[model samples]
Target: MKGITLLAVSVFSTAFLSFTPLNKKYIIIDAGHGGSDAGAVYGQFSEKDISLNIAKEIHKINKSQDKYEVILTRDADISSSLPDRTILINNLNPEMVISLHVNKSPEKETPKHGFEVFIQNSEGSKKLADKISKKFSAQTIVERNLHILRETKAPAVLVELGFINNTQDRNYMTSEKGQKEIAQKFVEIINEY
Candidate 1:
């Protein structure tokens, strides 16, 4: 939206987005922030690391299933410009685009915990976001626009997995079991479309 700023400047290109064979059903899992851009950080954990771990798990769970083929914006911890990410995602024309992220807020600024699913000003995206929110027991926000949501040809949503600053969110996201469960939930949501 108006006030929502993302890491849009890209020093990387389409090469940063790993591609696979063209499939009938496709999904693009964008692991937000990487390389020097650690995103939200708490202690030894970085938002980039958590996002990537969750994205990779989602890819692994769904890739071999033959329904929705998945591709990543960045395979590992590396920076890819926002334009490049959007360009690559739009080009794929995936069934949907889900950007993985972790939220952060100042401790004194009413620190937010739990999950949030963000959608652009579109009906389909909102529906999708809502479905995912229910799946995760998260809160859904309908907003003006995000680079990934506005630029992607497919339905898009940015999932704030949880707030790193929040103790419960931080623990759940960092745990192996929690990540797998989150990945499975996404697989179910993705296959429904």
Candidate 2:
């Protein structure tokens, strides 16, 4: 009986450790737009504010796991140039980079209000993008010629959380509940990979 109990405990401990790998560390979270660059503004809500809030939430979640060394591109309300942002990401060389932003569209009726993930023009990137998009159907994931994607040395993705200009999107993105859901979903996708 004693031997059986010891074996059961060992098996459970090993299984738990396998699911949570120790090597997975260092994630870069880039909050798009800062300082003077307000990004897309809908009523009183600005894209920069939304992005920062979501990024911070993501950081908090990742920290709780104790598996990732999460770093933010910009911690305060300061403007960072495109080149500067890329440089910062490159310097960090994290295992994964996630750039967060809110979308905007001129056509009010264009029914495109969801999260989209953009990866570098590569096969591996596409695979990662597809996995994340499928998990979060709220946003469509597509590739774009983004500076951050091209400049980052690590496997990176840029996420447009939602369209600030869209009335429905704006309401959800600015709300605390909505932001928490988005952040939680994002972490799940990352963990899945």
For this target, which candidate reaches the highest TM-score against the unseen true structure?
A: 1
lDDT of each: 0.83, 0.78
Q: Mark the regions of model 1 whose C-alpha exceeds 4 Å error after superposition.
A: 1-23, 108-110
Query: Which stretches of model 2 miss by more than 4 angstroms?
Result: 1-24, 109-111
Per-residue error at 51 for model 2, in Å? 0.3
Please provide, for model 1 over 68-167, each residue's C-alpha lDDT reduced to its tens digit, 9 standing for 90 to 100: 7888888888877787788767766787899999999877456788888888887778888888988988965757578888888788999999999888
Each model's TM-score? 0.85, 0.81
- The CA lDDT at 71 in model 1 is 83
User: What tens-digit string does per-residue lDDT give for candidate 2 at 49-91?
Assistant: 9999999988888777755667788878887777766665664
Error of model 2, residue 44, in angstroms: 0.4
